[model samples]
Target chain A: MTYCCALRLKDGLVFVSDTRTNAGVDHISVFRKLYTFGVEGERFITIQTSGNLATTQAVIGHLNNHLELGQEPNLYSVNTMFEMAELVGQTLRKVIADVTQDTHNHEQNNYYCSLLLGGQIKGSEMELYNIYPQGNFICATEDTPYFQIGESKYGKPILDRALIYEMPLDEAVRCCLISFDSTLRSNVSVGMPLDTIVYEKNSLHIPNGKRIYEEDPYFRQLSKQWSDTLRRGLQKLPIPTDDYLD
Target chain B: MTYCCALRLKDGLVFVSDTRTNAGVDHISVFRKLYTFGVEGERFITIQTSGNLATTQAVIGHLNNHLELGQEPNLYSVNTMFEMAELVGQTLRKVIADVTQDTHNHEQNNYYCSLLLGGQIKGSEMELYNIYPQGNFICATEDTPYFQIGESKYGKPILDRALIYEMPLDEAVRCCLISFDSTLRSNVSVGMPLDTIVYEKNSLHIPNGKRIYEEDPYFRQLSKQWSDTLRRGLQKLPIPTDDYLD
Candidate 1:
């Protein structure tokens, strides 16, 4: 399992993903799930993938091949973020179809994969999309402003409660880390060494992205602080009186 | 759908459940999911249910009939908490089998139900078990002192972080309510009024349990205070610095 989330704030986009992959409890491995495509001063794109690691790798392979060959419909050639999302979705569907063609139990063989794509095109506004396995996608709106894939529910309440469109980039990053920390504590399948990218809106260039490990001081401090804070807050809530009884 | 959780703490046991039931988006109703049975001064048991309402209701009906008829091998007749869990599990399996026996599409029908059973038998320690759709169940341990069913993930992190085997009954109850509050905010399928029960060890008689409604003043204040505390905690966390960037 994987856990990846992207936030499209008023200022920019934030992408974070865990790098833990497992075929079963015994067959666990670390694999990067975040990929980036960009042209300095023109456009930038980030994708975080979940499900069927082979399929995601194949799709990324196809995209890389297209860029290398300067194909007309590659990520580098797409004019807008919407078109880029469509391209990713289509590529995902094609890869799954090709891989499962010889299987007699196509329905039972779930070679499906999903992705969160977020970026900015030079002349257009920043955008975030959740692309499905069937070549369909939906963009985040002002009310939503975020997309999550993989083990999402454990981390969702924090995002739902704390995220707002106009929050500063740094604050948004803090929120995403807290969300990831909560998930990590609850799920063993989602491990450490997170990949995080912060894209400043309209900058059209990827800034320095961080790879956070368990030893990263800031992350360690944040995790401990959040836990302590929650415990303290819970302790402070007023206990119900006998009036609570029926 | 529902969200029900039970904690087997050292001091005693605590049970909490939401009262939301829905067939579809347009059809929603309130139904209590918590039930209690006991022979005062001898034994006590609490059951919180989730999944198919019909199946759960049928199982409960059978248990009630057994008690009313003074049948052998019934909840009252069982000698140990494990035997009681087995009785409930067997009854659940029987109910599902009866309901789906005539259906040609049994697999598609989904006559599935799950239960959390926690109680004490005279001279035995308190126990908690999570009963599955099949006639099988697992008991909670000191390391994992709580079990949740139906729409559980959204509320799980709090339990994971704050639950302790030795926490006071009131503190455990507070944690359960906060967990329920989180689930209520994120899921439309889980709602209130909530039913809460606190069982003190060796006390066979059931105390006056609380039935909390949306308009209940203490519950309302607790919910508001929790939200405010979480927001304030998030604000107090230190924001990341440029050192976070590569």
Candidate 2:
């Protein structure tokens, strides 16, 4: 299991993904799910993936092959963010199809995976897409400025209530972390060492993203503060009405 | 679909259920999910149900028959809270079995349902049980003092973070509503006109719990205030470190 969330805000994009993956509860391992690559000035792209590890790794490997071979419709050769998302989706679908054919998996989703593709090409608007296991995708819009993939519900309410398209990059990162914090506390499948990226809108260069470890000082402080605040905030909320006694 | 949650606290039990039932989104209707009954001063029982509407209504109807006919194993005759839970579970299983036998539903969960049972029999400690579709049930413990059925995830983080065994009953009710508010905001499957019960510990007489409608003033205040407080609280949480730029 994994928890990956991305915010497509007015400023840019904020992406966070946990590092834990497991075949079973006893077979857990740390695997980075976020990747960044593109022409430094002309195009920038980030991918956060979840689901079958083999499928995601194969998709990423195919993307790397495209980059190395300078193939047409590759991440670098794509004309726009939409085309980039389409390219990734097709590659993902092709990979899943090949694997499914090899294993004769007609209905099972053993080779299925999902991806979040976010980036900006030098000329077009910045964009974000949630690519499904079936390789179809949907982009984030102004009214719904975020896309969450995998173990999404536990961390969604905070984002639904607190996030907005105009939120600053720094604040968006904070919100995503809080969302991740909630998930980490409730689900062991989503572990620590979170990978995060803050892309400045139309900047066309991926900023150095952070990897927040379990003992990271700032994360520790934020989690503690948020917990304390929630307890206090809960108390401050008005009590239910006398109608319960009616 | 429905969302019902119950908290087993040191002070008492808190039960809340949204009043939405839908065969499809187009066929939505209002139906009360929370039911209270017991012999005053001797026992108290509240059942909040979710899942197949027919199964739940049939289970309730059977209980009514037991009570009306003065049956030996009726709710009023149950000697302990555990027996009461067992009775409900067996009845639930029987109802599902009867429906399934009629329809030849051997594999599909067409008649499946879940329930939250909370109350006390005089001379026994208060108890809360989450009865499954299979008729097995698990009671709440000191370590885990809550049970939620149907559309539960959206409202779970707050309870996971803030609820404790020692919370005051009024405050617990407030927390549960806030949880419901989150669910209502995120999932259209769980709708408004919530039915809630706050049974005081050791009080055998059932209180007339509130039906919080969409226009209920205090609930409106609580929901609005919660959104405001959450947004404000998000701002107060510290920003991520400059590590992203590292």
Question: What is candidate 2's lDDT per residue for A1-246, written digit by digit as tens?
Answer: 999998889988888999999999999999999999877878878899999998899999999987899777688877888888888999999988887875755555877889999989997888999999888899999999999988998899899889999998888888888899999988888998999988888777767888888999999998888888788888898876677754
Task: lDDT for model 1, please.
Answer: 0.89
State the lDDT at A114 in candidate 1: 93
State the lDDT of candidate 1 residue by residue for A163-193, as single tens digits: 8998888888988999999899999999999
Query: TM-scores, in order shown?
Result: 0.96, 0.97
Model 1: CA > 4 A from native? A104-109, A243-246, B102-109
Query: Residue B184, candidate 1: how far off, in angstroms?
Result: 1.0
lDDT of 1 by residue, B80-189 (tens): 99999999999998898888887777372478999999999889999999999887999999988999999999999989888899998888888999999889888899
| CAPRI-style docking class of model 2 based on DockQ | medium
Write down the worst ten-residue block by lDDT for model 1 chain B: B102-111
Give the C-alpha miss distance for residue B24 in model 2, angstroms.
1.9
Assess candidate 2 and give its lDDT: 0.89
What is the lDDT, from 0 to 100, of the residue B235 in candidate 2? 88
Model 2, residue B31: what's the lDDT? 94
- Estimate, for each residue in B108-157, the C-alpha lDDT of model 2 and write its tens digit: 49679999999999889999999998899999999999999998888898
Q: Relative to the true structure, how large is the alpha-carbon lDDT of every model?
A: 0.89, 0.89
